[model samples]
Target: MNSHTVRSLAYLTGLIIKSFGISLVIRSRLGTGAWDGFYVGMAGHFGLTVGSWLIILGIFLIFFNSFLIKSKPNFFPIITIFILGCCIDFWLHFLNFEPDGAESQVLIFWVGLLFTAVGISIYVQGQFALTPVDQLMYALSKRFGFSLMISKTIGECFALAFAFLLHGPIGLGTIIFTFLCGPLIQFLIPRIERMLFCR
Candidate 1:
């Protein structure tokens, strides 16, 4: 396969991995990533699949990101939206196993976090389109000269505030994921880039 084919595969694979991780995190009943939590709240309070909210909010971010970077909005991540939304719903429904206790829940949370970071890193390396939320990090980084880590942390904080207002599940796991995700993505992306791109 050519580079494009490889990238498309990686992109799709990463979305699946990320969605699976998201399902596990939600199922753990601990907490979820900030934006995922917001989506959860929206889905619970309003009516729609979590994926549906992800897509809707992501569309809003497209213009938000464009305004930040002072560029024409990129519609590429709309693809990311549809694919990821569908996959997340699929995993959320398909996975029927539940954590039996706090220890199990914590284990699942950590595992899910790991999968999420890895998936985000891998799909980013695909060099197609970053998911809209992830793209927000890039926009902020470009506009503000923040590191990816800082950019991501800031973005999640904004999402967290909205999640709180929306009455999402906010707890230890939410805080942990918020703090860890940025560093993990920072640490993993370079390593993943090397693995995928370095000869």
Candidate 2:
């Protein structure tokens, strides 16, 4: 209706597109991408569709993020991620392609994760409200006076550990994801913003 509304819609659409890419990467069956291993493993355990799990997690994260930042959840990205995640999951049913082995799969996993890093960088550059998990990290760092990077590392480490316990594939991909995502995001966010928005 207004310029602000248009911008928000655009940003939300970008996030959903990013989420759709993520779902495609996950469905690749080469291996679960680093960030997705937790969600996929949980989905497997619960016998629910990955999209269903993603939607549920997205809702919870949005609410939780709101609590941390006092920011209200918007409808666009929330609904988009939910519906697209389910769409991706359903689409994945007809395709089946697992990696060659643990080693080969790990390589594929790393590549998929690199793509995720790029996607995250682009998403942050959009400067929409932070995702729930990102917001939680921001809130924790602000309240505890830790560096945002450190807070993120701590949070990811915990997720990595849980993923391991759940028998999710953890490998060099995990290590690389943990070590590299922060600096990469920091570097790319600004560049992407400038390129996309000239700011």
Candidate 3:
């Protein structure tokens, strides 16, 4: 296959794995990451699936990010979001994995979080288009001269606020994920890149 095809496959694979990890977190009955918390809250409020809310929110974020960056939005991210949304629902529907109790829930949540971080590292290393949510963080960071870390924290805080207002699940897991996921992603990205591309 061509390089483009290979990259596309890698991107899709990463997204599918990410979706599975997210589904695991949700099923664990522990809190999810910020954007996911918002999506789950919106889904509950609107009587839609989490994946449906992801797509709807993703479309809005695409336009919002464009406005913030004062540039044309790259529509390619939509493809990633669409596939991600579908995969999330597919995993949720098909996977019977769930935590059996409080201790198991904590274990499951950490496992899911690690899986998500690894999946994100892989996809980002592939250098395909980013999801709209991630694009928003990049746009804000570039536009305001803030570091990406600060921009991401601010964005996630907003998501958490919305999730709280919408009454989504919030717990220690959310706090843990907010603080740790970025560092984990940074730590894992180089390793994943070496694994995938070092040959």
* Winner by lDDT: 1
The digit string of per-residue lDDT tens for model 3 on 27-134 reads 778898888999999988888888989988999999999999899878888888988899998988997776779999988898889888877777775578888887
| Runs off by more than 4 Å, candidate 1 | none
Model 2 clash count equals 0
TM-score quality measure for candidate 2: 0.71
Model 2 lDDT per residue over 70-115, tens place? 6676544465556556655764674356666666555555555555
TM-score of each: 0.97, 0.71, 0.91
- Cα lDDT tens digits, model 1, 44-151, are 999999999999999999999999999999999999989999999999889778799999999999999999998998888788888999999999999999999999
Considering lDDT, which of the candidate structures 1 and 2 is the better prediction for this target?
1
lDDT of 2 at 140: 67
Better of 1 and 3 by lDDT: 1
All candidates: CA RMSD (Å):
1.0, 4.1, 1.9
* Model 2 pairs whose backbones collide: none
